[model samples]
Target: MEKIARQGLLYDFYGALLTEHQRHVYEDVVFYDLSLSEIAEEQGISRQGVHDLIKRCNKILESYEEKLHLVEKFEQTKKLAREIQSLTKAFSENRDMGLIHRIEEISGEIVELEAH
Candidate 1:
């Protein structure tokens, strides 16, 4: 994944765990696309301080993902759900038994994922 996109996903999955101060600074940098100097000026902190905080926030978010695997499971489940939707549509259009089987298989996979 691209760096920005990866960061966004990590933030989405783990951002709520951050302290309010960390969330404000990290959101300014990641979500608002503010430069470190800009965030520093606005927050009345040093530029280096903003940079370090952002880095620490990123590390913390990544550690949460590494331990919990929620982000990974979410992505996988999303992909499987899309596939199931596509299979359902195809089955509806063609009334194909093969499509039905595929949809069932995908549903089973989704169930298995949720169980974990």
Candidate 2:
């Protein structure tokens, strides 16, 4: 995955674990696309401080992902869901028996993932 997109996914899955100030700074940096200097100006802190906070927040978010794997599971499930959608669309268009079997297989995989 791209760096920015990976950061967003990590944040989405683990952001709630961050302290309030960390969360604020992180949201500005990642979600709002604010530069360090810009965030520092808004928060009345030094640019280096903002930069350090962002780095720390990124570390914390990544640590959570390493332990939990929520983002990984979500991406896998999303891919499977999209595949099922595509297969279903094809089946609808041409009534292909093969597509139906593939759709069922993928749906079973989804169910197994949910069990975990």
Candidate 3:
């Protein structure tokens, strides 16, 4: 995944791990689209220092995702949720018991996947 995407997912799950300054610098540079020089000027740090801090923040975010696998799990959960939604729509529109039953089965599978 891209650094920003990875950081977003990690932040959703574990943002409290970062220090306040790290959080501010990271959010400004990565999410707010502030230029490195601008971020350095705003934060009273050298541009190189800002660049390095952002790098370190990226590493920290990536490390959490790698260790916890939250991003992967969330992706899987999202796919399963979509499947369930589709099946629910099919069940409502078509009234196919077999399809509904299949959806139920898949829902069971999703629950089982979540349990681990």
Candidate 4:
């Protein structure tokens, strides 16, 4: 993934674990696309401080992902859902038993993933 998109995913998955102050700064940089200097000026901190804070936030969020794997599971589930949708559409269009069987299998896999 691209750096910005990866950061956004990390933030989405683990942002709630951050302190209010950390979230504010991280949102400014990642969501609002603010420069480090801009965030520092607005928040009354040094530019280096803002940079370091962002780095620390990244590390913390990544640590959460490493331990929990929620993001990985979410991505896998989403991909499976998309595949199921496509299989359903194909079955509908062609009345194909094979496509229906694939859709059923994918749905079962999605259910099993969620059960865990």
Candidate 5:
């Protein structure tokens, strides 16, 4: 489930770079987690068409990620956020002053990434 969420985020990041048609079908099927039949009905296409468009869009998005690495950077940001959360939790429980400072720094870094 966690892996799915991570992949979904990466897909969304890469999806922003796709064409409108690709975005329409890909967003419906992937980001919304809709079934092929559901997407087909919504998009006025056959199930097979939706499936093929999704497959092609996936390839395009993957290619974009391979070259631009935005999705990779986004994943790294997610991992960093998790690590910062853990650090914050530990500092809260232990009242470690040094850990508090580190957490604050990391939190700032995560916020900066959010801007990008």
Candidate 6:
């Protein structure tokens, strides 16, 4: 993924663990698309401080992901869901037994993942 998209995904998964100030600053940069200078002006901090905060927040969030793997599991589940949807669509068009079997197997995997 691109830097911003990866940041956004990580934030979506792990941002609530951040302190209120860190969450606010992170939201401004990732969600609101504010520059460091704008964020610094709004927060009464230096531009370099804002930059350092974002850098640190990225590391913090990534470390959580490295330890927990929630983001990775989520991506895997989402990919499986999309694949199942496509397979179902193909089954509807072709009435293929192979597609149906694959969909059933993927459904079992999805169920097993949810159990964790």
What local distance difference test score does each model get? 0.93, 0.90, 0.84, 0.93, 0.78, 0.95
Q: For candidate 6, write residues 20-67 as lDDT tens digits.
A: 999999999999999889999999999999999999999999999999
The collision pairs in model 2 are none
The 10 consecutive residues of candidate 4 with the worst lDDT sum are 84-93
lDDT of 3 by residue, 1-116 (tens): 77677677777676678899999998897678899989999999999999999888778877887898877887888888898899888889989899877877877877887898
State in Å the error of residue 109, model 2: 0.4
lDDT of 2 by residue, 1-116 (tens): 88888988898888899999999988898889988889899999999999899889889888898898889999999999999989888888999899988988999999999889
Off by over 4 Å in 3: 1-3
Q: RMSD in angstroms, all models?
A: 1.1, 1.0, 1.6, 0.9, 3.9, 0.9
Backbone collisions counted per model: 0, 0, 0, 0, 0, 0
Please give the RMSD of candidate 5 to the true structure. Answer: 3.9
Worst 10 residues of 1 by lDDT: 84-93
Instruction: In model 1, state the lDDT of residue 52.
Output: 91
Candidate 1 structure quality by residue, lDDT tens digits, 18-112: 99999999888989998888899999999999989989999999999989999999999999999988888888899999988888899999999
Candidate 4 lDDT over residue span 1-116, tens digit each: 88889899999989999999999999999999999989999999999999999999999999999999998999999999999888888877899898888888998999999889
lDDT for 67 (candidate 1): 96
Please report the candidate that would top lDDT against the real structure.
Answer: 6
The count of backbone overlaps in candidate 1 is: 0
Give candidate 1 misplaced runs (Cα > 4 Å): none
Query: If both were scored by lDDT, which would come out higher, candidate 1 or candidate 6?
Result: 6
Question: Least accurate stretch of 10 residues (summed lDDT) in model 3?
Answer: 3-12
